[model samples]
Target: MSEIPANTRPLEGPAPRLKAPAGATDCHIHLYLPGYEAQPGGPKIPELATVEDYRKLQQWLSLERVVVTQPNAYQRDNRALLAALEQLGPDTARGVAAVTPDTPDRDLQAWHDRGIRGARIMNLPGGAVTHADMLAVEKRIRPLGWHLMVQFNGCQLNDYIDNLQRLESEYIIDHIGKFMPPVPADDARVDDILRLLDRGNAWFKICAGYEASLTSAPEYADVGAIARRVIAHAPERIIWGTNWPHVGVSRDNYPSDADQLDVLLDWATPEQQQKILVDNPARLYGF
Candidate 1:
């Protein structure tokens, strides 16, 4: 494997003060290898983020399990995701790939056999599947016992409420609803998120706070407040992630992985942290 570029990650940081519980899972991440080229209609390929580099991250954070989601850079091509799963090993890793309604059942079965447990629907600019195709794609993956990883502007939760209510397969809203220019915890949009969670099939992933936070740094106060509220409302339904390699961030603004994990200290209690880090993902992803 090629050397991971020095600028790609903060690989030399002190280990997180809050160690992850055993069987702890980082429920959202993306791994990139050299051979996969960026497809059209998505963001440009980021620096190579290899499984080798990620294993070091796992060690630093004390994370034993992972859920590697397909990055928009690769669009609907799942070869990179499959390759990462193979490298990370099925015992400790699972994958969420992008698939369309037309994806072959044979291929779906093949991916399932390789430790894939979910389908990703990133309904943003570079996303392969949108809200319009969500039900169709869900129909195709539902039989495989796959859940959906849906990411879009959480600010529009009200607009998408009907489709969310209609989802039959269990689904997770990525990045704490990914409310671009995130709203306050009391925002009506957050209430919409709470309503969906109350519906019993929806989950909330609290990660990537920098994606939507206007607030800066070690605290990310705005995002934390919202995360705290969500965790308080339904601790059982929450999961956490590092959003590792943080492709969208500039090198100068790259976040500390240890800090990312430690933020849970502020947002959740020890017991709730246990659930967010281990129990919740184990149940949701069949770890």
Candidate 2:
């Protein structure tokens, strides 16, 4: 085990000036417990985030649905993530789990029955899955009606475009594929993302703007432009999330839950906002 941050900040902040529509969902977030060890050779996301702590955030943001992603901190150890889904209740909360290609069929079915709608493969540095395992993992989850939620660098997506198109399961590209240095609006990466959305089997999470932006938080202007382009390309495929507890984020730069939600107003129209925050997530997560 490694040292985890205290995360003393209250989950309180200014209310988003734009209220989230009914059934609005935070499609990406995590739960962390102290003293838990990361998988060997995996990225460290040591932090103390709990479901109860996140309830305060849910109230602050007025979001009714959530999807708890199994974090790299507890790679392949989904006990905490499963507990969170139970605590949040299956009716309003769903989960995206981390599993190896070898994870048993029985276990996968159990997780699916308990409200896990997706399996995530973090291809970023220190992520659990390798490039070679992407399709194998997708094959494992396909039978369960779960999509593959992939997190990777935008610049690298083109490399896997052929594999992505061939996967039998529907897929979600996390954080607009987390484009680095926030590329130009017309960058080829943007077109690749658009092409993925055009396939009708893919979805995008319009979360974690700060991670992809060269600009700092509260504004995140450059990443916001890319997100806007994604929305313009396909509002129906875009869903919103706060990336709460902001694991691995420096506390000084970690944003308020409300501030993160407010950024969406700039990204979409009120009707588009409704689709991103509510309807789209409902369809994706089965809320």
Query: What's the C-alpha lDDT at position 122 in model 2?
Result: 85
Compared with the true structure, what per-residue lDDT tens digits does model 2 show for residues 145-232?
8988888888777787888889777888898668876788789878988988898989989888888788867778888888889998
Alpha carbon deviation, residue 170, candidate 2 (Å): 1.3
Per-residue CA lDDT of candidate 1, range 57-100, in tens?
88888889999999988899899999999999989999999989
Candidate 1: C-alpha RMSD to true structure equals 2.0
Each candidate's lDDT (Cα)? 0.89, 0.84
The Cα RMSD in angstroms, rounded to one decimal, for candidate 2 relative to the true structure is 1.7
Off by over 4 Å in 2: 1-6
- In terms of lDDT, model 2 sits at 0.84
